[model samples]
Target: MTRVEINFDGIVGPSHNYSGLSLGNIASTTNKGMVAYPRAAALEGVAKMRHNLALGLPQGILLPHPRPNRDWLDALGTRPDDVPETLRPAAFSASAMWAANAATVSPAPDTGDGRCHITVANLRTMPHRSHEWPATLRQLELAFADTRHFAVHPPVPPAFGDEGAANHMRLAAGHDAPGVEIFVYGLRGGAFPARQHVEASRAVARLNRLDPDRTLFVAQSEAAIAAGAFHNDVVAVANGHVLFAHEQAFEDRPAFYAALKRLLPELEIVEVPASVVSLEDAIRSYLFNAQLVTLPDGTMALIVPGEARETPSVWAWLEAMAAGNGPIRRLGVVDVRQSMANGGGPACLRLRVVADPATVDPRFLVDESKLDRIADCIASEWPEQIAPPDLGDPALWARIEQARRALHALLELDALL
Candidate 1:
């Protein structure tokens, strides 16, 4: 059987602090004003990337729209014409207001066929509260008629403080299989009552009656960290054997090593460093607006912010495989200037639709020795090609042009996605 993988796009939401909403409030927020514009633009870039990766079709699902608080556009000086056509409706919808800030979607694996499927989470909202279900499974069934397995978890009660379960359900439901696995974490609703927990457990047990092996139990980790704070810890379990981090590991050095020892007492723990951990912090920061997409050639691509943070905003494409980190390959980077005037990074600008391993030669992977030469070539020649307009301050324009060039070079790399 082909291995299944899960990729996450970072958080997305409205910028309540923008001037359009703030009105009389003079205090400037950290991600206020033009900053919010780039965030939106980055999301657009992600969508475009998703479209490209899916071979010009929708493959994966997009998370729930973020609620940046009403009047965020006003605070940012965003007018009706400023918003993209696809996002304009979402910006005003009530669903956008009450739903959890993020959701998950998936694209069909490229099995050589051009047909694809996409799944999205269903969100419900009441007067003052909101609730989530594994509703996306139902949607997946509808979207993909050939779906193999179906998984269902008991409905989770609404929690004013914690929305992680809801988000997880959305992601999990995007699976395209028929075998369903339900994981019970806690009480259905309200406070974690003892009786409620017992009832939930019983319900989960009853569901497993259909197929115990197919219906697996997953323990919710209290220590689960946010995608914003760290790179996701990927664990693959099958036939009683667990695979940590697919073929290699990312940033979970000390803790993950120990956890592996305990989880696989009889197995050897191997240390494999990440090939593309460079600019990880920057990548995480950018993920808030975009996602990393692996192309058919195994290259990875993400959009980055252009301004605000200490780093410059540009679309970053890397050839991790070329660096011999893992099966994933990196090509280069692409810089895009946000028309909205918001400073955006690679992650903020794009979404992923499809991620299929290519059948072509692996020789496309870049050699480590050649990386610096490539970077230097792009860094030096980029400025002359995309010169900044004279309207902006000379120095500021120069900096913007430089960032744009860097991004262009990154994107220009063959098979870089």
Candidate 2:
């Protein structure tokens, strides 16, 4: 069976807003209290999927999870009407739009049963994102329901914080071949919470039944985390056998590299030094958070945010790297400032799954026509803007619910409803 990597981007929901719910994310905090453009944000995400399709890549979509999560409020012994002001934003959060945090995926070639394994993340570090798993699990079960090709597991217990694929990386000679999987966990990040725990990573590896000898668990640099690299993907990304990272991404670089080399000697590291682009600039511009993907022609391209180009040092380093004789030969820039403002980049917007497209749910897959329909729905239904006060308005909540229902009807995914 032939398998290709599909980039499943989470469609930005109608309730998209910047509540500054994520404590460690600088962008989110900086943009908090500003009016958000939900309609434009969602259309921007749809355009990104279309961009992937034009690149000759398989694209899929994970619908926005239901917002104003009434169930969560009920669980907290409160109703929406009487819910405390502090808890209001959590219920309406659109954080699930960053699919990288939705789940950790192990492709078929690297799993024990020759089946793809997807384990939903228990994002317990932030209260706003903690309740996302249940809704996320529903989507995963539907999308990868085929027993022959996929095994979807519920989130690991919340005692250990797991931020999914954001903190995970897989490297292989080819998508269909056995690969080395690296799980990066963080112990501390000064005032920020270290989101990915080693224990959680270990549990996920065990659940997926990955080969111990081929899997390496490494620690994220405390400095990188403190500098605002909340997830490993923020500082490093792996596609095929290439690892593009910031120089300070890992705690013990030489040791991790040695262990990785022992597992897979063909590894290629495109480490951007701090001398050229400081870690502060790297995190601010989300340079490493860009998606490093292999193009259809076998050459690789880095899909980066427009912010990368705007940052002088980051752009200079990227241009020099691409111009030189290196494994990454091209650069693709995308405008996701709507998501960028909330601390997500092109990489954060997607979850990579290497599998036979035929086995996945057809409804979840996308092409240009499907995107047109999705975008049209957004234009007509999504709120034009949402301010802080709008979050508490029952009218806004009703509109948001109706907008999601309309999208479900359009996609014929009412099963998720």
Candidate 3:
């Protein structure tokens, strides 16, 4: 019954490539059509998991969804060979590696039934990701199959467009305590489509049976959305009682802050002003995309992508914050440039689930040995690199399938297939 926050990261798939599938994500678009290093990318993902373990945090992993997703392509009445050039990337998208979009979780402490509830996200916005729910749901059911302690639900009707935890935040004095669950939704983002709809947020809150009094639905800033902050996590992240964010992250910051303060009296708001770090700069550097975590020693740390350090203003502000007597006591920089280039950073690469480790499937959890095994698989089987054109090559498709199968056998998770 000891509930703790576990970061479940998605292992980068063998088909990791830069097809530029995500529209609103600036990094993904900027690097579209560029060559991608699948081997190095998967290894980077595993290394990030190792880094989390070294910090004394429990780390879990979700296996990569099968690539060249034959089933989905077959359903389209066209094979990978005959599929339109525009839709080819959808068959081999590695976007599922950003586990933040996996699901919306409500821990037992905050739910009426006293069991953690997880609802898979139906990523209906983009064609490449819309088909991910079935595979993602399979993994969720397998990982949280212990019905005595967990309740797993399928995605809400895709009509509502829910992007999952990337648009959600929970705050409380401690992990086990009942907290305020804030769901950030968007109405419009100018040229970019707002992925999380208000109705979808409401559906998830109700499905989890969260207390009406403790939940709040906030709007993401249209400005942030237009500036390539596709999800709210791109501009904000919450850990325990602290809400670390950019000043322009929300549509109505003052009202949201007032409401949050009322719910959690000790709430600390660490807002980086626009004068210091503009929204463009924040999105470009992925400064707010960092993981805000509580270390075993009870001190808070920000696990940021190496790009944050490269941005002069971001690094300076972070240094000043860590140097001061702030709630965030340390900075842990990690190199996930491969993921960063594809619009995912430390936070994007993880799904935060608060649950007892004993309740989760053992196969999904990892240690040093397991990480070593995963890294070995990636090094051996994953392709050295993938250009946009390589996705259509039958040989590369076969290799990708072989790599995933090797991992399935290695982890004894073939049932997930």
Regions of candidate 3 where Cα sits further than 4 Å from its true position:
none
Give the Å error, residue 167, model 1: 8.0
TM-score of 1: 0.36
Off by over 4 Å in 2: none
Model 2 worst lDDT run, 10 consecutive residues: 46-55
Q: Looking at candidate 1, what is the lDDT of residue 204?
A: 32
Ranking by TM-score: 2, 3, 1
The residue-by-residue lDDT of candidate 2 on 97-183, one tens digit each, is 999999999999999999999999999999999999999999999999999999999999999999999999999998989999999
Provide the TM-score for each candidate, comma-separated. 0.36, 0.99, 0.99
**lDDT per model vs. reference:** 0.29, 0.94, 0.93
Runs in model 1 deviating more than 4 A are 1-29, 32-47, 54-155, 159-255, 258-280, 287-294, 297-326, 331-417
Candidate with the larger lDDT of 1 and 2: 2
Superposition error at 27 for model 3 (Å): 0.6
In candidate 2, clashing pairs total 0
- Give the 10-residue window scoring lowest on summed lDDT in candidate 1: 231-240
Using alpha carbons, what is the TM-score of model 3?
0.99
Query: Candidate 1: global Cα-lDDT?
Result: 0.29
Tens digit of per-residue lDDT, candidate 1, span 1-417: 333332322212222112222111112112233323323333343443344334322222222222321244454456534543333322322122112122222223321122232323222222111222332233223323343322223333333222222221112122233323323232221221111132343343343233343333343222222112111221111111212222222223455445434434543322223343323333233322333333444344332233213332212222222355543333223333432122223332222222232311222112233333434443443222211121123343344334434433453522211
lDDT per residue (tens digit) for residues 1-417 in model 3: 788999999989999999888999999999999999989999999999999999999999998998988898889888666877777799899989999999999999999999999999999999999999999999999999999888999999988999999999999999999999999999789999999999999999999999999999999999999999999999999999999999999999999999999999999999999999999989988998999999988999999999999999999999999999889989999999999999999999999999999989999999999999999888999999999998778899899999999999999999987
- Candidate with the larger TM-score of 1 and 3: 3
